[model samples]
Target: MPLPDPWNRDSLVWRIPLAGGAAESDDNPGVDPPEAWVRALAAVALDLRCLRYGREVNVGRLVWDLAVDSEYFVSIGWQGARGVGGFSRGEGLTVDASFGEAAVWVADTVQSELAGYDFVQWPSRGRHLLLPRLLATNPAWVDPHGGRR
Candidate 1:
């Protein structure tokens, strides 16, 4: 039988192979990138001051449901390698985050950090995507194409 639907108000569903790899394979049954991704995400959660873990959740299960304030609940998971996560605020808001690559970091808000860059809607989700700059104003990201601003 097909696997049961895993999406709900409390869970995030992920696709596989990240860019192109599997969590498991028939010949090599032990390769699991999702597990590693989960570990990285959990470490990020621990370092984030904006998020607080509920009594039921600890470091071991940070990949599972997490309480985000009184009205919001968040969950993260992966099917193969494509990681998925989100932030939900009661019935009013639900932001789905998708990563083309699994190298992701979670923060309370990126508004301050991405200020002044042109942003676009990220797919159908309510979230915004920061546009890449031809000439990065920050000294650390100088563009080689001679478009410095």
Candidate 2:
């Protein structure tokens, strides 16, 4: 299994691993990455549909369902696409915070998870002050990324 510490981006840019894949090996016990990817793709389709048209985006099991060994833990009764879900396997980091605080910390955590994120730029780039950024800038309709923004 991949080591867990690599996912934490406390300081610099982060990278979500788009690793190649696992071949059909006798040693492999679980679902292959390709299959997992396909399943994830399908899941995204459902989420998008529900997110747009459904009455609610009620996620019952964040860690077990949406977040796969998601590795993020924060205190919240409700979570949309935003905010931390549950703990990832490696270094279990527990944070008790409001939405804004979690937003700040989670940005670092997920920015670490993204494919190419500059964490070093954080100290200077106002990432440390992201909680307000999340609350202030979050549009009811548009998401953070420019696609929605």
Candidate 3:
């Protein structure tokens, strides 16, 4: 049998931009989000056991990037001690957490956010192991010519 689609209708992935709006756009340019919001997001990343990475620019600004495995990542541009941030997934989902309202909303929905991340990343984590089993069980997945169908 064919493997089931990894993404389903019930998946809680956030495809739309969050409250603050699209992270990057011609109208918005690239405005740094509030420092509080970036800090909050970093805290959430830690809570979720994600890895945090950052760099300092020559101008004294800081840029932070956080990721969950190789699946999802968010980059925040910081100016001095105050900045705002945005999150994006490899699948092209983006959320702008620049405004106060957006920041508050993100904090309030932490549980759901975690669930969403887990749901999306679950299949990816198992794909390597699962694919071999699937191919072994279902020969139709293989081509007689020695390549995948």
Better of 1 and 3 by lDDT: 3
Which regions of candidate 3 are displaced past 4 Å? Answer: 1-27, 50-107, 115-149
lDDT of 2 by residue, 35-129 (tens): 33223323332322322221232223332211222343321111223333333322333332333433344434432332123222221212222
Looking at candidate 1, the ten consecutive residues that score lowest on lDDT are 134-143
What is the C-alpha lDDT profile of model 3 across 23-105, one tens digit per residue?
33232234443454444554433333322112211211223332212222232222232232323322221333333433333
* Top-scoring candidate (lDDT): 3
Residue 103 in candidate 2, Cα distance off native in Å: 1.2
RMSD of 2: 15.1
lDDT of each: 0.28, 0.29, 0.29
Per-model TM-score, in order, reads 0.22, 0.22, 0.24
lDDT per residue for candidate 1 within 62-117, as digits (tens), equals 22322222223233332211222223222222233222111132221221222322
